[model samples]
Target: MIQPSNKNRIVYLDVLRVLAMLMVIMVHVGDAYLFNAETMTFETEASLFAVLLRSSVPLFIIMSSILLLPIKKDNTSFFKRRFTRVVIPFLIWSIIYVFLPIPNEIAFGGPANTFTDSGLNVFLYNLMMVPFNFTGSNVHFWFLYIILGLYLFMPIISPWIKTASKRSLIFFLSMWGITLFFPYLRLYFPQIHGECDWNDFGMFYYFGGYLGYVILGYFLHHHNRLKAGQSMAIGAILFIVGVIVTYWGFIHDQNAFFKTLALSHVENWKLIEFNISFLSPNVVIMTAGVFMLFQNIKLSAFMKRVFTELSVFSYGIFLVHYIITLWITAWLHNSMMINPGLEQFLLTVLTFSISYGIVKPISFFPRSNYIIG
Candidate 1:
């Protein structure tokens, strides 16, 4: 079993953070081009990339679990650190997004327009709605709300995790796995109406949702006994299976929706958007495999430096990268034609680079960490 020290940073976790953030950008790039594609071939290629990158957010969740589940610190310190690091920036970014104009091409698929007319009202309304809603000005900020909810439960769950036996952890994970299938169950068996409740007892409630990823991270980090070779083999198989499931699932759904509803190509594409949810079994599997693969990697000095720099600015990049991605994608959309795959790759790179550049300067200012970190 490997236990992470609170004082010492884990190199593999840093690598995972860098990779995950890049994947997040990749998915956004793919979305920009794929949704607007005029050719089935381009859409198909982009969809494959998007599905493969769906594990990006799950990786972030799992990495958070690995770092926070051990609970070696007190609640006061934990809350204070998390608040300054996460909550404050989330609020700042939420406000920024509220006033920031949505590109009209991206917003209404027409000429661009600024939000100056009703920006104040929009900001106030978003501020009011943020507490109860995840769809603040930026759709991607839903992650902030989810992570906050997870943090709320961290203190409550950490104590149990500290002393949890392997069997107990396995039981929790098994229940979590069962809950992952609930979406499909509901889809196929609409008549199954009752909740998994036994006279007000939330039997499956405690063992489900993103909490499963949390516990899974802790289990893999603390209790996993597999060798590097074994991990590599398992990771490869799981990753391949996840790719097949996601790619084929989306394709199947898109075709079915087109045939059944006789919808346009873009409308059919939207129908399978839910296929990329983090709760999907394929995404979970891919996230686990990728996490395990990184766990077994030993970084060289050059790679370590690069990963560390990117990891340090990862939070800021995540908060700001969407804007960069959208602008670059819009520019590309208006510019000369290029291959969708290449456009996505270029957009992702540019977004990451520009966001990193912007954050790096801001990070040097006094107390800027509160806004960016």
Candidate 2:
């Protein structure tokens, strides 16, 4: 067990972290065979799976807020922690991902590869870009920028959040409404972007989810506010229903634009295409279900203990898992032939199990311990 600290000990938060990590893995695995340009074999493959996977990233952002918001640290200290713990690992893993295919593909008489081939130039270029802007498969590293941004501004924001007054909640809800609604509002107003908007700031979703979950976490932590049983029951019901609706939307809709208007609640649909990235009712509902389940569920003691061990590696896993998943997908696609649907399902499982198995064990390497934990 983690020792007592100035921070509150919600054993559940660790469980949440582990769940978020698993969600991320599931999202990527589903993405690889279902929607990835290289692996997608059939037109009908990218169905409800993409929508449901959409919950992963937002849930991760919310989980970050919950975990970090309670900590008492200055901005400088926070940066130092992240720079060492997050930024450094991100850079190292990004470089590794950049170079991974050379050895594997070279032996098969495939094309040669390098950092530029893998888009590392774009990744490195973003180090100099303005905040909230990115240019490459910085892949999963974008969250670090959001986390750092929030950490810097937390001292200013936490005061209002802590008050827990109706006014504060209203202010936050208003911000959320404007940010979440701003882009779609553009479809009607066209000039809405000219108005003062938090979405214009680009950090809005990250800020909104961060602030929302953190403030919510603080209240829950302080008051012991959640009842796991009731919350889980409600969340599971909504999650399943959301999945069904999201599936129906994808099957019937062809235009990416109409689909966004159709299914908004599923989680990983952003990977489907750029136009579908905007807020839709389905997207919001499904993501809410993900957050609810994350916050409310209880885990077995054995599972919780396993999560405690693995959650330390969560950051590293996120950073490296994409490349690992991609490689596995490519290998399976090339080496063995399977039916499209089974291939998709097996690819998902193979990618998840292999990536986690490899990374989780490597995460225990003594030299890597400082980087992962």
- Candidate 2 structure quality by residue, lDDT tens digits, 122-157: 335444442334334444555566666666676676
TM-score to true structure, per model: 0.87, 0.71
Residue pairs with clashing backbones, model 1: none
Which RMSD values do the candidates have, in order? 5.2, 6.9
The alpha-carbon deviation from the true structure for residue 83 of candidate 2, after best TM-score superposition, in angstroms, is 1.9
Query: How well does model 1 score by local distance difference test?
Result: 0.77
Candidate 2 residue-wise lDDT at 100 = 54
Model 1 weakest 10-residue run by lDDT: 105-114
Best by TM-score: 1
Stretches > 4 Å off in candidate 1 = 1-7, 37-42, 105-123, 191-203, 259-271, 334-337
Q: Tell me the whole-model lDDT of each prediction, alpha carbons only.
A: 0.77, 0.55
In angstroms, how far off is 13's CA in candidate 1? 0.8
Error of 2 at 132 (Å): 8.6
